[model samples]
Target: MSPNGIISISILALQLWHCAADLCNWTGSGFGADGDSRTVLQVRLRCTEGSVRWVYPGQALRVVLEPNLSYAQRTTVCIKPSRTFRGASVYIERAGELELLMTDGGRPEQVFCFRADGPQRPAIYLQASPQSDVSRPMVGFRYELLGNRSAAPNLGHSGLQTSCRPCNDTELLMAICNSDFVVRGYIKNVSHDPERQSSLVEVSGGRVYWQRSGVFEQEEGTVGASRSVSSWHGHIHTLLQCHVKPGGGEFLFTGSEHFGEAWLGCAPRYKDFLSVYQTARAARRNSCDFPLD
Candidate 1:
């Protein structure tokens, strides 16, 4: 049982399962041929051998992730779950601290937090437990990090800092690193797709004309539960708190896609966000990577 009165399941018997496939580690920056740097790396934990099959009451699965933190100022750890992990709650044990950062009893797609002030690269302990009865065992999990924040100097693009709310570096980095297409553009237009009509997006580099729905699709038969669509679909999302005016100003946008069309949404409020995208773009150029699809 944890100090917080949560009964977590410890590793009864543990073995690194398929270290090559599961351990998807990468450096946020400072990529070298030798690969021995204090960059953040991703790791996976699986219950190859465990104490229980069905997650009973008062039992949870806990896996600790410890990365080399010698060269980094701080680290941000994010856990992405596979489809098998159902009815699970995420708990993050802060490095060098006993207090835990957990979801508000909700099933989150991903759990991420920053270890800004730790004595060392403390082991980021990630634990997940079932919230439902007779749930399936947690087979494994994956983690990723932006490893070289400290070594990389501030690129004079610390986000548009206004009195209202400051831009979060972690959020911007997550969107930038995970996105397929990052663009510098403007919001072409805003309209309601009552009949789900296609909208045209005018960007600086290029133009995107496609049919997309901005409305949140609810489950079938849950009519009227759907959310009203927004005009910011192909432009940029406001989460990054960008200084965006309708059909005005050039902004750095990060993009993802579905069904062979570009979905421009997440935007980083830094001038140098383009540089970050360029870095990722250069790496992907050789592979002929999938662009915004």
Candidate 2:
């Protein structure tokens, strides 16, 4: 399962499928191009790899994608893109790529391909049946990739520095649950705390905004839960940490002001950061509790 426990599949007919259609291996015979029996680039089916999530100090999530292929009817094949890269919601990131295996199976073993990392596109594709003398073409093909990540998926290939993130309103509250940060926990205290140090966040849905940390620190400011905004039914979460010293330490939560309400409400969903990123991209929409404005 690669080093990160990601199961690899050389072939994917069905069940637990994650490989690209292009990997199916295309040849000279084949079908319609993109246009028709005559067009040179017909889009059959497309499947994409997951996104990237959290990586520690030095790690990277690598993904390779290609199209399913075959040349049953005088067809020439090429890979359309089949992989992507994503970052946290708070920050903006351009589309990214992974190295793809050559269709012909030659020396340069792999090349790079980009996944649809923009807004609104999900990881999906079509499997085209080349137009032939017969009604529905009989021959079909598949695609594949060599997807794997480093020891720390959270870190990028460049070893981007990553800090702790207070998920959305849900996880943020959960993170706050056991801490002293919510000393007043009344969701009523929308005001920033000048004495308390750490970021706060509240997720209503997919929206995400930020609030300043009240406590003094030499690092980035803290964000309150109420800062995120649930937009267009998509989760947009941001992680804000109450800057503390390096190394493992204690997370002091001040519980809600309510007599029975718990602070930081619950525990954030624990997941690999790189996985989170890739999942978000492939789904084309996030499912986080976005903080409000």
Query: Against the true structure, what is each candidate's TM-score?
Result: 0.39, 0.17
Clashes (backbone N, CA, C under 3 Å), per candidate, total: 2, 95
Residue 249 lDDT in model 2? 19
lDDT of 1: 0.37
Question: What is the C-alpha lDDT profile of model 2 across 18-111, one tens digit per residue?
Answer: 2222422322222222223222221223332222222110111112332333311211112222122111011111232112222221222111
Pick out the ten consecutive residues of candidate 2 with the lowest summed lDDT: 84-93
* Model 2 stretches astray by more than 4 angstroms: 1-28, 31-38, 44-46, 49-106, 111-115, 120-293
TM-score of structure candidate 2: 0.17
Which candidate should be chosen as best, given TM-score against the real structure?
A: 1
Each prediction's whole-model lDDT (CA): 0.37, 0.25
Deviating ranges (above 4 Å) for candidate 1: 1-22, 25-58, 66-74, 80-86, 104-107, 116-132, 137-142, 147-182, 189-237, 240-245, 249-293
> Tens-digit lDDT track for model 1 on 76-194?
44444434544334455443343344433333333234443455443333333434544444433345433433212121112112122333444455554455455555556543322
